[model samples]
Target: MDYSFTTIGALIGMAVAIILIIKKVQPAYSLILGALIGGVIGSGNLILTVDTMVSGAQSMISSVLRIMTSGILAGTLIKTGAAEKIAEVIVQKLGEKRALIAVAAATMVICAVGVFVDISVITVAPIALAIGKKAGYNKASLLLAMIGGGKAGNIISPNPNTIAVSEAFQVDLTSLMIKNIIPAVCALIVTVIIATILSKKAGTMVSDQDLEKHADNKKLPTFIQAFAGPLTVIILLALRPIFSIVIDPLIALPLGGLVCAIACGSLVQFREFAEFGLSKVAGVSILLIGTGTIAGIIKASALQYDVISLLEMMKMPAFILAPIAGILMAGATASTTAGSTIASQTFAQTLLNAGIPAISAGAMIHAGSTVIDSLPHGSFFHATGGSVGMNIKERMKLIPFEACIGLTSTIVAVIVYLI
Candidate 1:
């Protein structure tokens, strides 16, 4: 039922999807169309094609649910004023002179609490911009700083990309999260340093002056109330690593949201906050399903066999190939979740079959997915770049720095895998 005509069929299907995505079609719709074409061509059997696509989608149901609930936790973190409070404290302690580090650190923390990377950038933009202005740093530097931090945090956080890869590889969520921390920290440090260097050379870049500003007078939550929810999530999720307890992210993310709702006294507005978070990831959740369909088609195709054969011919290790697969796919899709999802579903099994450890391979692939997940075709490129008034040329500047940060984690993961 799989691996026969996959090479040509999956190639054609993926080509169609990439073209549609480039033409500004919604990724979900584009991917769905890709699946239909790929399915029919790969198997020439309508019933088998439908079954394969459905099976692939069904494979992602558990992960998708976790992603949706993460929206609840991420939403509550923002709605409760915790995200801002955390950012403000970090920037204040570091002082304006260290604004680049301060902003990147704050963003890393905010995103560590399961906030999507694009939203994390948007959330940190105001503070980053203000501090950059005070410190004579350009908008591009600040934007890059925030983005680099986001890329760093995303691999370790219980974000959709993390969830998809973890589920695909059958690794424990907490174990996967815990295993990635050191690599994330290393990547973050590199990201901040690069961004700081970029600031020195900013020279005559566009300013943030024309960007519209908004005001809010809502009472800020006390520091304890603000920090409590995220801290609890981290603690509960860490038990598996620290003490061998097995709390799944699905359990931890919603529980953290509930705590945030209660501690921030936003329990009354719980529904609204949850809705807000879901709204942000609504497109992403659908995109995950769409990627799943493509993943299914590929699974039934011979594309994987060809790729593995090439790797073997080059005497490449599966661990190294794993990350490359992730980087390329995510780069192609311009979305981490989709990239990691497809990479894991299509290649993780192959890697495992080649004797790579699931958790290690999963960790490497997860980091690799973040490396180029923000390409121009995806919403992340426009949404994040547009948020800070970046035109196409300006936005392109951030890609290399962002990739380096993610690549740092991926390299560290490869080392860990080898060890």
Candidate 2:
């Protein structure tokens, strides 16, 4: 297939898949079908199309296997009440007067340890929900706080997106973290403020009496024991540079789970928690695999090259093009990591050639890619909804608005970086 046809076909496939996803189609079907269409149009061979789809799915599963460990850790925390103990301690220390802030702060710290946003949401939702009930805060506000803070950490910390950008630019992890720290902090602050305002304006607050029903009376774990698991994982991640060791999430997370289980005196229940955790994450895992498949197909089609070529031919300013590219790709893939990686790979050199600093360009790309990945169809959105006990329609009422705020913050970050 010629470059022009392949390019147009790939674009069409992406558009179709994104539209289907937005319309509430299952990502598995939409992405697979989209890949098939692109493969057929680009390669003009039926066998190649099937191979591409299979290979794409397999590759995605391999890449994300470590992330699945997070699910096990989440389950252990929830089952043992360790997560709730952490939340209780935070609220107790900060007081109900600053309840919302406490929740946001806790969420930021949890996600900053490089936990997946979906897993973070799942692990924290019960605790946040109970806190909201006791404090009479709006449930939506609590949910937004968790999501926003988690997303900020997910995008900027030593997670998949940061790793992807760091590799793409050949920069060290510390450098990427340094560049992203300010923007991530800014985004988190904006999200918390917006969530609080929206909660008050919507009057979605629950009565304390109503909240009592959701409260658990189980003996809360000691602060040190409750926090031991997450702290261990965080410390391990932090020591990576000093030890020159890669702490794979797969191993680290399971080890954390074991530690947390033992600390809670529930070591025997570890197997049960692991089973439950895998079940909770099963659907999301499938969705991620599908997303990876689509990403693989896009790569195989050499669409990134065509996209870069088109942008170069248009002579668009790096500042102007960077955010747009980040938003579109991130939105389409429903993954900040995939989007940032694509943007960096396609445009990092372009921006540098245009006299933009690599650090600044990377931060811009990372910020832009993250904000829109919280779209209603994204896995993070669904996970939050399920964790908070809200249905899709109910979630749609507020999630999109908050996500728009997130997108705006990132856009501001882009402008600031450029300036």
Candidate 3:
């Protein structure tokens, strides 16, 4: 016995769990439970089970803390009314005819920055929520806009997810980002168009009275509060290649969040700030860290051989399999890097063994990954949707239009790859 569960069973279980969670099962609980099951069945020891759980929890430590900091930063911004001011400035510049453009622009910037930083829904959601409130815009629509922005960045940015995926595929991060930039730009245009049409139909019912009531009255804190949130993250990312000489992004994420929080004013007490950070970050952290750890445990425990054997079945016809697998991975993991990297490595490798051009295989998968990267479980989508009070179900309803945007982008990507 090679000491692994049946391949079919493992695949089926993974598929079921992924679908169920994507469909609406709480990810944190589902992931924890799934890891437990994997531990018990794969290893058969309580002590090992305990270690698996601990490791899973441990993986989230850095991400969770960073998210918490983001939440606190967001809270501070809101309580201090800094976000409101920024929105006012944005609205002033864009005027009525181009508010949607501003929204799209903000979303793009956030998503781009997110590529190299934490990009926690916890952090992004609140900021979107405040913008939505101030502008009388439909929250869901705004969030979806942000999703388009964030997901686009995730595939190409130097963020952890992209880095992880790129490393797996042995590709350069800047090259990947550059290669995908054209399609990403096209996708962004589509997203903006969609947001504009939807915003018009979603019918901004936000009354002038309501906007006035929530507007920020503060004179503004140091330049930090004014330029915090997404700005800081962007600056950090721009300097990251050189600054990795100093601290890691994981640490920088919280540090950025903390700077935002302190600059936002007295809205959040130290304790409240702490609590705010914990709750916001906790949900996302558990999902990413827990699932990541479980994947790690599977690798460490040598269960990947079973996965490898199954992948062997799809060795020929690299183009189709690569893209399909990449899309599937993106949809399942709800992360750009995870999906693309997995597809590039696993599917591309299969093709390579058959003497196929790995670039064609990699390109197809990367295309699919871009589209799949916008799933409901994706933090970019969730955070954007959540920002506008559009929870998962309502968000899913918008999938058709989003899918169209993604489809267009994927087609373009495929064409580029083929050419």
Candidate 4:
């Protein structure tokens, strides 16, 4: 892993890209530029830049597809009014003094569902918003609640990312969860408690008039009715894989998404379905492409390989590396799911192949992913911020403490795993 001009350039480019993203520049474009600059720095030749960028683009295929599928499915849920129905039911249940806790709990539940479904923004936030308005608190509280819940689940839930990482690292889900769930739970509890205290101390109360004005007044479908669609898709997706036992995620993803769409009554004849699907494709595709491209870039640069090498070189104790890597990657990626998934699947797997303990590797990977997942720049935080209307700065104040619970949980899990 000697440093080359290309390596130095890539590092600088990455820094620039991060700064741009922080400045609110378009992520896709920023990432692309970063890749280009990194390539140029590494090779020091104009001709190499084109090839490097293409290499980066090529690498993103899988990630892009995953994100695209998730986005479109999410969009379809929103457009079809399925998400709304679910959110409505959640709001009705969050009815009084313990309103904050209700929102937190509901958000967590919805996020857990989102892990399998993969459209957390649409899946978790609408319910949070409805509940927040009902309880007369700012949308930020509700939004953060949803975010914390979803973030916890994103790392802990049955996401392909989680599964992929676990399997790659030679660990089981049960082992990882046993060690990680407590921290995730604590983070969420803290988030709700903080919101509740703030709401009360600030004397935030929604008047009857305001509540009535905000109320939809439309009768929603029953929870069973609403849950039926997603539930069906989940079962089928589960079965589809076991049934085939050789299916790829790309095909399976759309299959599950389509099924969910149909279950939610999206089958409004071929022509209408075609039209709606077409309308949504652009946004969804962009999101997918962006993430994929970034993933591709990482792959192409052999960062995963390099990271694994670095980890091997560390020669640190299992207890130490797991939390350190998890925290660093989570902070770097702004996604526990992404950070943990990548590190686990890449670095941790490499370590396991090198004969590290499976449970230790598993616990560490989970620890790394969850701790960073709580950061302000993380995707979950951004989605929560958008849902609640808070800027990153405001979110920073509360989110870190919640995330710490996850970090602490991860550390404890590692210690226990080591023992």
Writing each residue's lDDT as its tens digit, candidate 1 over 167-268 gives 999988878877788888888889888887888884444355633362356677877888888888899988988799888777888889889889988899
Tens-place lDDT digits, model 2, residues 231-280: 87766665666676777556777788889889889899999999977776
**Maximum-lDDT candidate:** 1
Q: List, in order, the clash count of every candidate structure.
A: 3, 0, 2, 8
lDDT (CA) per prediction: 0.84, 0.69, 0.54, 0.54
Give stretches of model 3 more than 4 Å off. 1-3, 19-25, 36-88, 114-146, 153-183, 196-225, 228-246, 258-275, 297-326, 333-395, 406-419
Alpha carbon lDDT at 25, candidate 2: 86
Give the winner by TM-score: 1 or 3: 1
Give the alpha carbon lDDT tens digit for every residue of 155-266 in model 4: 5544545544555464544344445566567666766776665565443233444344434544444566456545644554455334644343445444554555666555
lDDT of 1 at 41: 84
Q: What value of lDDT does candidate 4 attain over all alpha carbons?
A: 0.54
Ranking by TM-score: 1, 2, 4, 3
TM-score of 1: 0.96
Clashing residue pairs in candidate 4 (N, C-alpha, C atoms within 3 angstroms): 6-42, 59-296, 60-292, 60-296, 64-288, 64-292, 326-368, 334-378
Tell me the tens digit of each residue's lDDT in model 3 across 1-419: 24333333335445655765677777655555665666666666657666756764564455344444445544444444444455445445665556556655544544453322224333344444455566666755665566665555554454444444444455444445556667677777887788767776754343445445434444655444655754665456545354544344455555555566656655356456547546654555556555554443443444344444555675633345556666777777675545554445444445565554544445456657766566666565665454455557777767776666666667766677767
